[model samples]
Target chain A: MRVTFPHMGTMSFAMQAILENLRLEVVPPPPITNRTLMLGAKYSPECVCLPFKVNIGNFIEAIELGADTVVMGGGIGPCRFGYYAELQQEILHDLGMRVNMIVLEPPQGANGGLWSSISKLSVGQSLWHVAAASYFAWHLCKGLDGVLQSLDLMRARETVPGSCDRIWNAAQKSIGQARTYRALRMAEKEIRQELSTLSLHLHKRPLRIGLVGEIYMLLEPKVNLHLAERLGYLGVEVHRSMSVSDWVARHLVPNPRARMHTRKVHEAARPYLRGFVGGHGLETIGESVLFAEGGIDGIIQVLPLTCMPEIVAQSLLPSISQRYGVPIITLVLDEHAGEAGLQTRLEAFVDMVGARKVHRGGGVSCAK
Target chain B: MPSKIFLGLDVGSVSTKVVAIDALGHVLARSYLPTQGQPIVAIQSALREIARALPPGVPVAGVATTGSGRVMASALVGADVVKNEITAHATATLRVLPSVRTIIEIGGQDSKIILLNHGVVTDFAMNTVCAAGTGSFLDRQAHRLGVPITELGELALKAASPTRIAGRCAVFAESDMIHKQQTGHSLSDIVAGLCEALVRNYLSNVAKGKTIAGPVSFQGGVAANVGILKAFESALALPIIVPEHYDVMGALGVAYLAQPTAGQTRFRGFGVVAADCQVKGEDCDGCGNRCEVVGFRIDGRVQAYWGDRCGKYSHVNYLSVGT
Candidate 1:
């Protein structure tokens, strides 16, 4: 059975297998774009951010393409993503789209319930088999991500631009053809060996940029202009504060009793807490402040236009900046964005961060 | 050391408020006034009022600004700490109630319900896209119904068999209220129905899945409507406690955040009150986004700017300005 999925950040393969293992057809959603934005705008409230519009468009498109099932992940927190499934469901229903949805709660919340998920998965297969399949899928995806990242580093160093793309395309083709993890592992080695043979220059000039803003934008490279890639291409190692794993960690293990700092973060954010505090923008502020105190080189606050929560954080950031003496660039994105404009600002921000490093005598605090 | 005075200003779309506190965080004086379109003029007016009420020769220490128009005014006044309404609101709630579990703030154009678990905001939601469940909606409807906004609470109290109105949006709700009136529904009942619909819309829209526990307080301009208060109580199956400064809670929250003392003064000098302030937005042709870059200038000098796709504006230019 043919299957499709939305181009989720770092979750393309795992979702494929999860659905396939469940004996369901996988239909991939279309990539985010202006057309998608228009569709969401046409259907959604004009007040929602661009990402919400994009996702709704993705779901709508996928559903129209005969994709009957959808999977989304988020926790009940400051980010609007937590309410996305609910709202998207409503939108889809209003649009007369019939589809099944899987809303995965962060596994690391106060009540970590992995067993229940396993039970749900085991409905279509044996518990051992389902668990094995999930593990295999998870590892395969991680393995692909690790290899892709390394290849990317090599590709960026190549004197020739498209030459690296050639190798990457070849490697991706090989990995996609692999049916088993063993096969995938073998393909990874071959791809790495070939990538190493290409004239490659690798240096350790990592830009410890503290990314603060919307969760989806941070993770979904397509939406954030593939910022991590762009930074890496500029010979900078990117350190993103968000990941699906971290999302689960924060959601299930929210304010763990064992960690004093976790408790502190919860308390520090309590006063500003509201249902759907509407954005994870403050996560960026908290991280930026943390990064600053820890001596990170620079902070990037990325968010969508008209985003209320990030706007709140933006208003609060100056104090955090003043407190830590860290230089931060807060970027507000919207549909009218152009690559040339983005690249210029990114180049300027990077140059500024680099110059500031020299000014600070290269003292970047790399503490978590 | 010279005595220090701290100031906090909250410039909302509806009103401008300022509070002066001595070094020990004791409020020395406070003033509030309608913003009336020109925030710069309103702020100066507020400052003049505060200055008139304040004792003479009180050296200023530090100043803070909060609210939607805060970024503009904070830069104008060189505020030391420019914060959001949420943080400011939390600060005020904690200072007063200390153990407030929830805060129901219904402002002029928007409404929010913040839920706290042990002084931490665990869950919160805001309604900004529509004015259906906000104080402004009530005001407009009151004007349309030929009832004074101030007497809305009493009018609602008299609404027997409250008329049912679908308050999902202000326009629809108003039309529905009119339709119900045409059907010969009692005005008091209709008013009460409107109140219920507003409360219900707020709950479903903003407070969904949020367990607003007891010790909850209602602040902001709309809290002044007793009909809405009773509606909230009836809807939540619990009573809502209205704060003393209900009408000026946003400003009050900033006061709590300012927490000024005798020596910390970040005021750009009251001299700025008279500075020619021009705030406007321009559509950036830099990208397809065409972001409306809001530029805040004083005396032709760009003090702060924001609303750009990249950090093209907020950065570089805001060296002296807070975010």
Candidate 2:
């Protein structure tokens, strides 16, 4: 069967690798652009967040390209994100596009777990092949995250604009071409070396900013207008508050070693927010307080417009900013967000942070 | 070898302003004109006016552009610094009132509330996707009442008791004004009521959740209206300081920012006003999203491109001819 799925930044590459390793035909969704948003908005509920619309667009486009089965990630309670897969299936069926769906939900007590979904996806594959494929895919995921972390650090200091992006594209291509876990490690090593030795002058002490908020908006560059790269261009270092690999470990891996950092973050978040209001709501508060205590220059919170959990977080952030003596800016993004307006706000925020840095006797340092 | 000056241009949807300043940020010359839907022509006229007023042969060391049309103005003039209107307005306000914490700027097409602490902007909010409380809506109401925009404030001040009108949106406000007028409400009271409605709208929408402190300064094209000023004072219970150069403050603020703290300027010279220029818009068919990219050409050669999402056409080597 030909399988397909929606795009979520570099996560798509890992998904592609897993299915292909299973000896299944895979069709990756097209890169999101204005067309994707426009087509998706046409058929979606008016008030749904941007990611929901984009997912529908991906499914429709994938169906058109001969993909019969759609694989989607699953979430538990509170946030509307958990309902996306079922709602999308209904929408597609109503539109006369019949496609099979498989949700890779984490093992709940009665749900029979990841093994059932894996068994279904592996279909006619051998047990050893499935185990090997899963191992390779997980390593590839970790390797890609490592490469991305290195690129984020280097992109801020690169002397030439868009150089890191070029290197990153090449790295993605090489990583995709790797057929085995060992080859994936080799590709990661090569790319890491190239990225480290890029003949660009590094900024001595760049202004560091913490990025936090909704998972899809943070991971998907297209959705956020390449925000991390844009901040890097302005000579600011970025520390993302969350990553998909960390989420996978906490929710799907079922290993004690994988959850230490998230557990600590949850404990730290308890003082300000006691319970999880929804998707990443508690984490947003926790990370901001952590970044403030960590002496990061500023924090930027990005939330999809009308997102319930993030809306809760957005309201609480101001008090956190006040109590912690750290500056925070919350950007609520919808399809109607203007590029010029967004750029102006980001530029002004950076200027404010830079000024504050100088005021605190912290000029650009060569401490790295 | 004479000491140099800097130039700042604020090109808005309804008006264009120019200010020239010396090294110490003293305003040397200034001009304000209606944009009239042609930003290029408006910019050229403002530059010409400033040029005529400048002391003979005093070189402009640097130039800055701000406002919604900043990109177009920058491409036209080769600006040394391009800033957003918020920064420009805040800079101008701080210089005029050093202790100022809140700046209420209501321009022709938009309005903004800037909150500053110790002369640094801490927070700001601009009216998003709405025109209920901006200058254009007031202008439209003025025109419908057969009174020129310039005299709107005076007419509003003459009312003894103003009528109450809905201020949620422009459409609702306009219809409410007409209903009051048809039901035997005087022109002055209706005008006064319109002013109050705009102030209500501005307070609820733009200034919502903002900690507006004392020492407030109001500036913009709309600041010239005494009625709106009175409405704001009564609504917020704070006296607002309107600067002498309130209308051209954005240009003035950008001039302060454009002045070189060190190093030479990248000023393109006053001669750019007379250069042959043209802008062309074309649809890019590189992908399914056919973005209408605009190309700015000087002397029949493309200088820069804009409006393309993917940067495909814009990033192409244009200077190499056959490339």
Best by TM-score: 2
Which window of 10 residues has the lowest lDDT sum in candidate 1 chain A? A359-368
Once fitted onto the true fold, the runs of candidate 2 whose alpha carbons sit more than 4 angstroms away are A106-110, A113-120, A126-132, A255-258, A362-368, B1-3, B108-110, B127-132, B136-201, B261-263, B280-295, B305-323
At residue A228, candidate 1 shows an lDDT of: 65
> What is the C-alpha lDDT profile of model 1 across A1-368, one tens digit per residue?
33445555656656676666666667777656556767877888777777877778888877877877667654555666678777887888877777655566666443544556445434657777776666666665655566556544454465443355456557546764455777878987887787777775555455566677777777676678767656655555456665643543454344464245444454544444422355575565566666676777777778877777788777676566556656566666765565444554455456445645654564531100
C-alpha TM-score for every candidate: 0.54, 0.89
Across B1-323, the per-residue lDDT of candidate 2 in tens digits comes to 23778899999989999999888778889999999999888998999999998888777788999988887798788777888888888888877777888999999988989888755677777775566879889889889999999999999999999999899999999999989999999999999999999999999888877778988899998898999999999999987899989999889988888875324665667887787889999878765346679998777877777776544554453323221
| Predicted structure 1: clash tally | 44
What TM-score is obtained for chain B in each of the predicted models? 0.90, 0.94
Docking class of 1: incorrect
Predicted complex 1: DockQ? 0.02
